[model samples]
Structure formats: C-alpha cells, structure tokens
Target: MRLVLRVGGLLIAICLVVACADATGVPGASGADVIFSDGFVPGQMGNWVIEGDNAGQTAVINEQLVFELADNNIMQFSTLPDVTFDNFILEVDAQLLEGDLGSSYGVLFRMQDSTRFYRFEITGDGLFMVERRDGESGWTRFVDRWTETPAIQQGLGSTNQLRVEALGTNISLYVNDELVHQFNDATYSSGTIALDAGTFVQPQAKVAFDNVVVRRP
Candidate 1:
C-alpha cells in the first residue's frame, strides 16, 4: 500500500510546494484552552492543504472537509501547516458518506515531517488501530492488527467522534467518547496534526470531517 503525506503545507506526491493561507480558530468550549478550532466552513480552511486528482481528492464542501479516495492501497491526508503541539486533546466528527466497508480513516498527530508520525484510525467495520511511521525505517503497529471494538459505529454513513489525548510519551485514543486504547511512545514529542482517509484493495471512499477542536488536556 502507498501512503501519501502532505508535508510542509503541500501535497508531496509530486514534491510541489504550494502557498497556504493562515488558519483562524473559532472559540472552543467554555474554560478550555482551545488552540485550534474549525467548523470547515467554505473559507475557514486556512493552512489546511486541499488537493486532488483522478486518484482522489481533499476538499471543503457544504461546511465540511471531505476526502475521496478513488484508488486502492493508497492513503490521502491533509494537515494544518502553521501550528504545532506537544500535548493536546483533539476531537473531530468523521463519517463515511459512501465507500467500501474495508476503508479506513482517522487522525494523524505529532507529525515530525513527511517521514514520521502517529496514526489513530478506524475502519468502516468497527475496528480500530494505532500505528507509527518512522520514515524509511518502516512502520510499527502498537496493536497486532485491526482490533474490534464496540466503541466504533459500524458501517457507512455512521458518524464517529474520534478523540486523541497526547501528553509527553503518553497517548490515549477514544471513539464515541469511550476509551478504546492507550499507550506510550517517545518517538515524537512535538509536531503538527493531520486528518486522513484511506482504502485497502477497494476504493471509492468518501469521508467527511467536521467540528475539529484542539485544546489543552
């Protein structure tokens, strides 16, 4: 499978650097140290990169950020290039509008660059996984494989609230506000974050994300 990393505010599939607009944060929950928040409304994409081709596309439409994958064995992601966080709690509502049941999508955090990052993703079939990418050194899975969980809503058109709480080497993952996994890894201490959608052997996955908020834990 091929993984596409949006590095340095540009889709790096062609190694082309594109200019990105600055992001503006919307007010978050009361009493929370909100760092970044976006409703994904038309012009609020800010530094989030949007790119697509015949293979797939990442766009903002109808007040939501959407990712469509037209090819199998490839993952496409978009990141906010201007902000970095060492520790924070990020939550986003993600739904599979239409796609293969084997398709997967979720959040990527502590991204050091195009080479390294941590991923928390769930399939359309109620399975979740946590993985780490260490450049050319290869990938490391925190779990053996996709683990089944009741926390995730199964099937397409089901919205799941994905949350990640990261502090130092400790990280926790939650689905639908229920804790699903937790672990510690010192590979990355501080970096930006991203949202991604991917497919396996089956393609045509359209995933939409909205109401993203990043705040202090």
Candidate 2:
C-alpha cells in the first residue's frame, strides 16, 4: 500500500510540473522570448496609445483588445521610439472578434510616418494583403488578394499567426505555419513596427499578441 501511494504521488508531481511548463512556455513560433505582454488591466497604459478614427469605439473586453460592433471599426497605435530593426523576425497571434464578418486587421512595418509604411493585413474574410502607404502615393495595393483563407470567411475567435522578417529589402510572411506572402520593397529600409486595426462597420474585432520576439541579425 505504501508503494502505491508513493507511485501515485510521483505521478501527481510530474503532472503538476508539466502543467506549469505548458502554461509558462512561449505561446507562439519557437525560439522567441516575450518582451512586452499586456493583460489590459486598467491604468496599465504605457508604451501604447489608442488612436485612429475608431479609437473611442474600441475597448478592452475580458482583457483583450476589442473593437465594438459599430460602423467604421477603426483602431490605431502611436507609441514613440519606433521599433526599428535592420534584420529581425516578429510574430503575433490575433483573433478577430465574432460579428466581424467583413473586417480586417494586421501588422504594420517600416512605419516611418502616417503616410509612409507597409501594412500586412488579414481580412475578416480570411484574405491577406500587403499595402504600401507612401508619401507620394496613397494606400497603394502592393498585393491585395487571398493567400491564406478565402474572403468573407469567419476568422474571429480563430487564432492566426502573422510573421514578418526584414533582411535588406526582403520581406516574408507566414500564417498559421504556412508561408503565404513575400515581397521585396526598397521604399523604406528601417522604421518602426506596429499593429494596425482596420476600418469596418459593426464588425467586432479583438487581437491578442503573444510571443513577440525580436532577433537581431
């Protein structure tokens, strides 16, 4: 009977350790350390700002960044000291809130200014597009088509991964462990990286970013 108890205790201890490890392990693509993590606790606003045409319409729902189900679901971020990387990798996990059937959101890189940046967006319809906002040219579609999932498809509540790697003028993207998009643009070489909340109507949107690791090369 003593032996049985000892064995049972050992098994329990092992299970507890495994559970802890899983909880603490990095939540995304491997080999990345968490630099910034936000649970959206009130008064914890630092290094982040809510802007854009729909800023006031957005809020934190259950500690997640969420956009209301209203027309023109706009969201933006204007944190200073722009994260400039010469060569590095960035990954974020996001989910569009339910009811956002035709909305979109994604990451923006090389954002030198409001009018100069590259936006990698995933539509609520499950389509991915890469756009360039140049000073001379407005939002020009560099690549506007579906690569991961079809358009008008439901993605809210479904976690998707977005990755960007910048080495010189080469930019690559991966969605849910699949390589979906790649581009070579010489417009802007170095600038900040940001998350973009798009404009949609009555579309619920929420994004959770985890395992945001940056490796300099």
Candidate 3:
C-alpha cells in the first residue's frame, strides 16, 4: 500500500511494501570515457548551483557538495546547469552528516528542470527508492515502496556510493557498489543531472556529496 501525506507544506509519499535485489561490484565507471566530473573543491562550483535561504542551503565546502535543509518536508537540489547527458554511467559518494534517519539524499537524472526528473534516493536507515516528478502534475514511484537493502551503510557519518547507469529505457541503481534496483521507463530520454537531499518529518538534514563522475555507457 502507498500512503501520501501533507507535511510542513509539501506532499510526501510512503510505500509500504516492495521487493528488490542486492549485489556488489565496483562503485564507479572507473575506466569508461569520462564526460564530466567534480570533486567539489572549496568555492569552486563552476557548473553547479550554490544557494542559501530560509528553506535550505547548498554549497561546496571542504571538497564536498553539501546540502542543508532547514525545515521539515522541504527538498534541496543543486544541478550542473550546463551539462546534459543521456545513456551514461554516473556515480557519486554521498554521506549523511546529520539529520533524521528518514532523510534521503541521491541523484536526479534526465532532469528537464527542477520539477521534472528521475530520482534514486536512499535513507540513512538503509531504505532506498526510485521516483519521478513531472512539474505540477505529480510524482510517480517506480517501485512499490521504499525497500530495505543491506547495501547501505545505515547511519549518520557513513558514506554510500550511489551509482546510476542509464541506457535507453533501461535504468539501474546501485548503492555502495551493490546493485539495488534495475528497471525500465520511457518518460524521459535526455536532460541534466543533479544532487539532492530531502527531509521527512524532523528538520535539519545535512548531506555531503563528493567524487561525482559521469561517463559514456
């Protein structure tokens, strides 16, 4: 069953049951032809957005891209404004510095804009989800629910390697070098990418992302 709730001014959905697989491998597109990369060196975010306000803040500090959400039910994301990709292998290291265990952070791909994209998210408590957004229309869950997997490191201060490989309608998601889900969708074909973090109930979510690389698949 799926439950949708209105919390802190945003609509949130929860999936009650889902089935997924787990398998391990290297985290990145190590030897593939590189298309883009960012180590997030301090004060050097050429293609990424940096912003701060009452809702949240995003910045590059200490060699990492960080997101700090100030309120519950709010989501924050920073995108590579000029980079667009299709049929590529993208990977990054995301660590939850501090937040509620239910908070999620991950990659958004085929992002036509802020409100239109595909997201692969994992919570600090070891649950993962895949979903899509289509502007004011609504959100769609690719899986039945937020499924649990042993692949995530589970807890604050733990870094998880998040990877996504997209080829045509086939998209695969991985966490900490383990395959978590693979599915097919034709909603979007090509667009930009982003890193995002969102809060569920409690606020103050701080997540840092690093070593982002995208390669031709």
Clashes of each: 0, 6, 0
**lDDT per model vs. reference:** 0.79, 0.53, 0.77
Model 2 residue 21 CA deviation in Å: 26
TM-score quality measure for candidate 2: 0.68
| Candidate 1 worst ten-residue window by lDDT | 10-19
Point to the candidate with the largest TM-score.
Answer: 1
- For all the candidates, what are their Cα RMSDs to the real structure? 4.6, 17.1, 8.1
Q: Put down candidate 2 lDDT per residue, 1-217, tens digits, no spaces.
A: 0001111012100000000011122334244443333434445423344432323244445545454433343444322233455666766667776555555667777878555677777776777777777755456666644345532235567777777777899988777767777788898888776655544545345544443445564
lDDT of 3 at 59: 71
lDDT tens readout by residue for model 3, 16-58: 1111111112245245387776676543334443566766777
In the range 1-217, model 1's lDDT, one tens digit per residue, is 2345442222323211121434443445335487777776666556555677888887788878888878766677777666789999999999988989878889989988756889999989999889898886767889887899999998889999999999999999999999999999998999888888877768688999888888897
Could you arrange the candidates by lDDT from highest to lowest?
Answer: 1, 3, 2
Better of 2 and 3 by TM-score: 3
Q: Which stretches of model 3 miss by more than 4 angstroms?
A: 1-32, 43-47
C-alpha lDDT of candidate 1 relative to the true structure? 0.79
Give the C-alpha lDDT of model 2: 0.53
Question: How high is the lDDT of residue 197 in model 2?
Answer: 53
* Residue 29, model 1, lDDT: 39
